[model samples]
Target chain A: MAHSEDVDHTSHGQSMGLLRVLGPAHVWALGVGIVLVGEYMGWNFAVGKGGAYAALIACWFAGVLYSCVAMIDSEVTSTVAAAGGQYTQAKHIIGPLMAFNVGLYLVFAYTMLEAGNAITLGFLVDTVAGMTGHEGGLDQRPFIVLAIMFLAWLNYRGVLATLTFNLVITAIAFSAIIVMFLATSPLLGAGEMLHKDLMSGQASLPYGWLGILAAMHFGLWYYLGIEGTTQAAEEVRSPARSLPFGTLAGIMTLLIAATLTWYVCSGLLPWEYLGDGVNGAVAPLFSAAQISGSNALVWLLGIGTLFATLASANGCINDASRAWFSMGRDHYLPAWFGAVHPVYRTPYRAIIFLVPIALIFALGAPLDQVITFSILSGLLGYTFMPINMIMFRKKWPLDTIKRGYEHPLHPLPAISLMALCSVTYFAVFLGYGTQLIAMIGFYIVVSLWFHFWRYRFVKRADQFTMPWPRPRGY
Target chain B: MMDTWNYIEYGAWALSALFGLLIVIDWIKIDTTYSEEALTSSREGELEAMTEKHRLEG
Candidate 1:
């Protein structure tokens, strides 16, 4: 039997790899930090497909789905306590093939989200400049490149610095949303925001129930990256305890923030206006602040939106790098990708390689396409969770491993999550047929390359061991 | 009717503000000492010892 002791650690040039310094607060920061921007933007597109009320229902459904998934994730992550998040958990339960695909899909999802943030940030800067009567706004390409580079550099510093920065910025971003909501409360009586003509607009729900299904993809934006926090399992101080506390807390925060944001934005602007193309999608909150004629609130919303973008991009880099690092460590990817910076003790190589790819995607794709692609990839990767949970229960039996937290409804929650993921995956496919096909083709090509080319290299290389210390007498 | 709806929106905003305040307070009260390098090294040592014992048993 190849025990963990026999596995090599020096292939990556780091002896102890990825210092464990994060606590529940840091985890909460990461959990909320990563998904904070979602509360700010990308969610209004749902208003386009399903009017405000339908979008709100979709948001509630997504919230319930996430709440269930978070509970199960807390249980699984606390037990596994690995860096790869779903990818690593899938590895222990499913085979290496599923792990490889899931890992790549996760990296793609995070990178695409990072790209989406960069693009959205560019739009926001342009919007602000346009509003202020500035000449031409900053060029999107150069701005996105610079932003991705800056975030990658911040991540390279260390996880502590990353989380600390995340905490401060996340607080500011959340404050901005609250301020927007409070400022917009008095303006709600002026417009028919609640009972708007839903079917009059071009982007109206033409396909009826199918349109609501399509809206589910955009609705998912409210809680899209909440699961990404589990990727910090390795760095956290006590994975079993802190992971659950942080994840649950983060979910609650997101739910409250999402509800407030949707309620305010929908009530402040007509659903038809909120659902229009790019400007329509992002203008609700800013327009709301403008309604109060408070320049300070407008500036706050602008600055807060920028910080929210930064937080999302920065957090995605952290997640994508760690997932890539784990794959490299396992020899599923090249050993070079697994290399940690000797000084920073961070996965510097993975972070560097991923930024250019994110920049390329950001420069090429529009916001809605980028968001749709990310949602599809993320949901595809999430499909593994329920299966993994069922397989784990059967493999280890409950009492075998030291469990940090347990889900209330054993297989039921896992089953429900699986059903939700499946339905959502199909919904995304039906809504984004061409884009989904393209993504599926990309996955197939990557999987084929992994099997033929990557598997050989991994077999040739010595097996890499888990870097974290395991419990005694395993 | 509009007044009722406006009050409800105001109530939601107030609740959101309360939640945000609590989160900020928790963040402020959190102990940063655990993340210090010295403490991290100490914990790593302890974990290393525990894992070494497991390796020996295996």
Candidate 2:
């Protein structure tokens, strides 16, 4: 098998290396950190479709699905222990073409999600000010741009600083959610909130089973970015052990957090009211604080909202840039993106490249559209995981690879996750319509660019070899 | 059908509890240490090898 020795291998004047400073704790923090803000918003929109009850049901299903997927992901990450998460795994299992597609999907997913967070952060700032009797909302464009640039700079600073920042903010975000639940769970009449009447009239399963289906994508918010934790595999200590522990622990934490948030928030306000409003995304937390009349808790929730957004965006910048770095290192992208900073020992160039794209999307796109695009792209990338799992098992065999953890159910988890993801993808396509089509168009353009341009670069550079079978005729 | 608000409530909590149990089991069972062979199999270790080879040749 040929390898990609075409990599420049120099960081200008200084050498390059990704510092291995992460442990299971840092990985867990990252896993939770990337997805924590989902509890803040995005998930609440499901209530509009399925009511609180149906949305809760969807959350439960998505939770189970995510838990299974996380376990399988842990197994793969433990074996490969590579950066770029799914892309790296897929490359070893399926070859470069598919890996390129998956890599692009992941980059799109993370970047779009980061942009979505920036937009949400803008909305959150407006909500915070509005609640404090400040009139009107702030323009979110400049704020989103500034936030993206700031996170880009932080990521350029290096992995330890980035992960440490993520860890501290994630801790604070987790605590705030718990405090919100505890403070409000007592004030609201749980019975009243969950009353059958809440689901009455036209709103009662408005779209029937389809409503539940539509809600699945929203429920995905709770665990959307946890898989990106695997991207940190290259930076972690004893990744074989830490990846599994971190990802599993993170999934479990998210499960409890999602359920508790659903329980507390669903009971605090009428499901209809919680599901309404222009700022519907953050309504649950906002309503919880408002109804409870706890100014301190409200402030805490606000601060938590801010930190959660920053943490998610910051973590995503780390993940997305690494994906770009890996591709660039392998010659799938311009070699410039592969450059590491001498001082920071981070992929400074890739991080810098990501900033402008993220800023453009953050400023130009609407939040709902960005969220849909992000989820769809992520789900498309995720469909490869199960296939990779089955392929990896066949190629490496359990006896050959030094796996840190193995899925007890083997192919079943992979099959189940694939089916669920397919269903969710179909539902998202149906619900989002034009946005999904645009995403498909985006994929086609990327694939074409790779075939006509990047593949030639790889071939010329003598790094085109892959472990898996190449795409036909290529 | 078991699709009521109560059903949703209990079901979510049940799944959460189940996940919590799995986490506890994993915490107890998962090994934190890596064997020397496993360490060598890591991406970082591979990079280190390449760097060393480059240095030796240069």
Name the candidate that leads on lDDT.
2
Instruction: Write down the lDDT of every candidate, Cα atoms only.
Output: 0.74, 0.75
Write down the C-alpha DockQ for each prediction.
0.02, 0.02
Please provide, for model 1 over A379-450, each residue's C-alpha lDDT reduced to its tens digit, 9 standing for 90 to 100.
887777788878777766666676788878778888888888877877777778898888889889988898
For B6-57, candidate 2 gives per-residue lDDT tens digits of 3434544455355434433432232122121221121223543454478779
What is model 2's native contact fraction?
0.00
Candidate 2 Cα outliers beyond 4 Å, as residue runs: A1-15, A186-207, A277-281, A459-474, B1-45, B48-58
Clashing pairs in model 2, backbone N/Cα/C closer than 3 A: none
TM-score, prediction 1: 0.82
Largest TM-score belongs to which candidate?
2
lDDT of 2 by residue, A1-474 (tens): 111211223212223457778999889888899998888776888887677777888899899789887988999888666677888787667778888999898898999999999888777755555655554444455456556766776677779888898999999988888877766554642333443555567656666787888788788988999998998977897887899999999999999889988877776767667776354435577567777777787788778888989999998999999898878767788665665554456766677678778878888888777877788888887788888888888767776656889988888888889989877877787788788888889888988888887787763423322222333334
Q: What is the TM-score of each candidate against the true structure?
A: 0.82, 0.82
RMSD of 1: 11.1
* Native interface contacts kept by each candidate, as a fraction: 0.00, 0.00
Candidate 2's displacement at residue A358, Å, is: 0.8
Question: Residue A442 deviation, candidate 2, in Å?
Answer: 2.5
